[model samples]
Target: MEEDTDFRIRFSSLCFVTDHVGFCGTIKSSPSDFVVIEIDEQGQLVNTAPSKLISKILPEPNNFAKKTKLDLQNLSFEEGSNQEVSIFAGCSGADQYHQSGSEREDTISDGTSKGEEQTVDDLGTLLDEKTNELLNHFACDIKEKWNSKTELIGSSPEFSLGRILDKNQRAILHSAIRQKFPFLITVGKNSEIVVKPNLEYKELCHLVSEEEAFEFFKYLDAKKENSKFTFKPDTNKDHRKAVHHFVNKKFGNLVETKSFPELNYSAGNPNVAITVRFREKTHKHRKRSLFEYQDRKVIYTDDSLRLGQLKGNHFDIVIRNLKNQINDSANLKDRILEAIENVKNKGFVNYYGPQRFGMGRKVHTDQIGLALLKSEMVEAVKLFLTPEDLDDPVNRAKKYFLQTEDAKGTLSLMPEFKVRERALLESLHRFGMTEEGCIQAWFSFPHSMRIFYVHAYSSKIWNEAVSYRLGTYGSRVVEGDLVCLGEDVDDEHFPNNKVHLVTEEEESANTYAIHQVVLPVLGYNIQYPKNKVGQWYQEILSRDGLQTCRFKVPTLKLNVPGCYRQILKCPHNVSYQLKEEHDTDVKMEGSHIDEATLSLLISFDLDASCYATVCLREIMKHDF
Candidate 1:
């Protein structure tokens, strides 16, 4: 309903089509704005027919306008074509423009001039106002259309359709209007719908453009349905369950030693240390740590036996001596026997008593030595062992050190002795004396003996090897663990103090030998002919009768002035002519002999040095 200056172009009598249907007319401008078009029966512009004299035809009255008109002409058909058409007009000149509601109301006041011929510009202004009002209403309606399900954000036209129309929006709108809702209206400046049904309920494949239809179907098929609920198993829960099973089956409620008995198996009470007196054969009396003695012979002593220093290898001797001095009603021999069996099955029978020996202490030695001591004392203890006690203290300790094969296929049972060595070092550090004597006093306990044996052996095996090499200012090691021993030079200049000695017997290694093989090389030989002369070459040279010889001439000096000129100048020389005349006499004399026979006597030495000298001096002498 709007128009622009160029919307309906005027050319004398005809008004070009400007509406969606390009119906032309004989409408002329009367200085007013209304268009009076003359549309034909089919709604096409009526072009003026041509006269006979001008048969070639006047460009057919606005051919450009006619083509555009033809495009819109199909819209007015019986089935209505179901196609929408759009055209543009301007208020100032644009095809579309907005107007305030107040401005639109003021324009409506000119009712009296409605039927009058308004200029094209005046009609365009009115149309723009009406369209703006429709657009506002359309935007509000579009929001209501999507509100229930789509969570619409605004009633503004800007929200109804995006600011710029993309291909998909245009295609969807075009298809939706044509197929689903023919009455659907869009009235905004951009012509976007205000309200429409949600069409997602329909299959996506039905609505997309032909090129995208297959992809849309695949998209729908790929969107999987969600599960109602799910739960992933927790692996931590299983580990805890496994730990629970192990605790129930293996460790029970408390950790008890497999090789030791319950604490109450001794004399109904724990044994405490006792001191005794002894008489010598010379009638001397003395107090001793021995529990039983005869005539000061000290047959049995608590400290010595406990520390594994008891003299005899017989268990009965010690047991009988203990019995001879028992308190009135007790059977001491039986008690001693019971204690022996107790230690044999359990770990500790006698505690390492107060005493010291060797570079370190003998208590440590006793712990290691006593376990392997199968004397009568231990034999007495062994007599009481049941087959079920096969894995008793002695056996278990041996297995821990990997001395016995029983430790295979189980958690590591033997304590790593190095760990014990560090612990002993720490214990020794707390004694506060550097002289090492104080350590000996407290080190003799049976318990210390056990701990020390493990620690000492660890120190011996794991400590660095201390071997020395040569020539270094301090100790030189080719490759071995050793402390750098500082140096001093001897007066004799003999480098004599380089001897390396093993600090401990434990440091020695077993010996073995390896052997190898070697090879040598000798001198060189050369071969040469006795002479430089070639015999077959000389024989050929000697036979001559107007003989020709082919010489290999070098090409390098040929460009020099003398080379080609020398051949010409040779005959021109007087020396060459005289030589020829003098040779005539000799030539005549030699001719008396047969020419073939004389040819053999005409030999020349053909010296290589003489030829080389002549070629060098005459032909190749000049640089140019």
Candidate 2:
């Protein structure tokens, strides 16, 4: 299907397949544009449609005091919809319920369901409108400071929360503070309350660049000889190595190290601080190239991919799903066959395609994946609730859930087809509003979906890697490039993970093909290219708030073992013909095809992980 290219290409990795000034065309004029028939590993053509009919009907929950109903199609707040939520639901607290408004009224618990109004105390109370606004503003600032000065964990800066004169309201104030600022430590003494950055809970070190590092050291006034210019110590070995790598890249030869015990040694991590000073004037700088600076460990590509071609039969697929009569448009029907031949022979840039990133979404799926990998469950949940169109009904449901914590009402507003959203809601409803519940809600998704998030995030990086390779080096395979070692081009039994980095041995003999070169998806197990692109991977990952390491969240039990993907892919036996006038007579199941005259029925076969939209995008030279 056609999509908005600007929203998807953040890294600006878009490059063309061939220099063909092709004609323009539109797609997704009708639902027929999304029709895709998948060819399985056994060479059987399978129609790509959800065959399992779903008719899930959920009953009402006891959290809501008012009546609610479900609407499969129209999930609106108006009266004509199938369901209507009369009042907001509260959390798992017995007597505490949230009111839907600017200021939610928290009921006073009298050991019963009776409701009573409460006043805002001198502590950091969010019950009042002004106080809530102030808390939000300061909370954002403190969070930033906490993330930046992560080295000062136990001794973080503190902020006064005024006096909590009433001892009875102190518990209530503490509860409110926890809700707003989870990463904070609170103390009340002699009716005076204060909060500090709870750095022990979170580990964040703002990633820096070479120039930024130089500026940081300069700002510290560490110019004199024997000055201990130390990079912040981290338990995350990957991040430490990344910082060490970049530091060594710039100042390894200039500085001489005198190793000492690791900072925070009692934490049981084998992390050492980069404590060093300028070398003596008599010592000479060691000669080394950029390639010699990479970690000594030899990492290989994912073994799943083989350095070979995919041999398969091709079939016809729709080029563009236009609505109105199109035979009159730009003589497209005449030249489409020629364009098909060009794409079939030359192939297109093997991009991950906009579909992988959740095209048309307000927040891409990969972002949600990144949050999950980072163990930011709340952030992942919020990103998942993001709506493509803010004004749509989905946004209303999201807002309602965020404000009132009403899982049942949110699910009612969500579309029936949204299985993943519904799954999260059901999980929350079953598990209640607890910290464990949030993690369980994340676990409700299928493993394939969980993997897709990380893969999508990596795809963004991979797309950039490919673009840089092609844009910088063009079609020629350069030294330090990687080539898979296999028995035959199509041998399935060969160990595909063993790869040889291009050097004088292969480049001089012209041994490997361009298709054999591969790129990694940025993870712990996967390797990088031997040259600058490999180095670029570490820099990019650090910039994106991670190092190339395993995301082993014990609670989530999620591990993203990275894989390899070939930079380019080709279509098999591509051929095209004009759409028939009588094709409209043949009706598709549950939907009608809008007849168009000038559309092309271009058919081609692509290996798994390849996108048909990209192949068509190459031919059309348009967003479609």
Best by lDDT: 2
**Candidate 1's residue-wise lDDT over 171-272, tens digit each?**
233333222222222222232222222222122222323234233222221222221111112224343344333222221211111111123334442222
Q: List the residue pairs that clash in candidate 2.
A: 316-603
Give candidate 1 misplaced runs (Cα > 4 Å): 1-444, 447-463, 466-624
Each candidate structure's TM-score, on Cα atoms with residue i matched to residue i, is: 0.10, 0.51
CA lDDT of each prediction against the hidden true structure: 0.21, 0.53
lDDT of 1 at 618: 20
Candidate 2 lDDT, tens digit per residue, 1-624? Answer: 235566656524477757654565566432223344444444544433221111112323211112112232322211112121111111111111112221112212321111112222333342355545655566676667545742331122444445545544644564445433555534443444345443323321235443444343332222244456665555676766656554443333344433233533554565555565654432134222211212223222212122332233234454444332233354555456556677777777778877677666567777877887777787787787765445544577777777777887787776433445666888888896577788999777656556667777888888888888877767667788877676344311213356667996777777787777777766666667888888888788788777744755566766766666677677874545565443343222224466645566555677766777777777766563
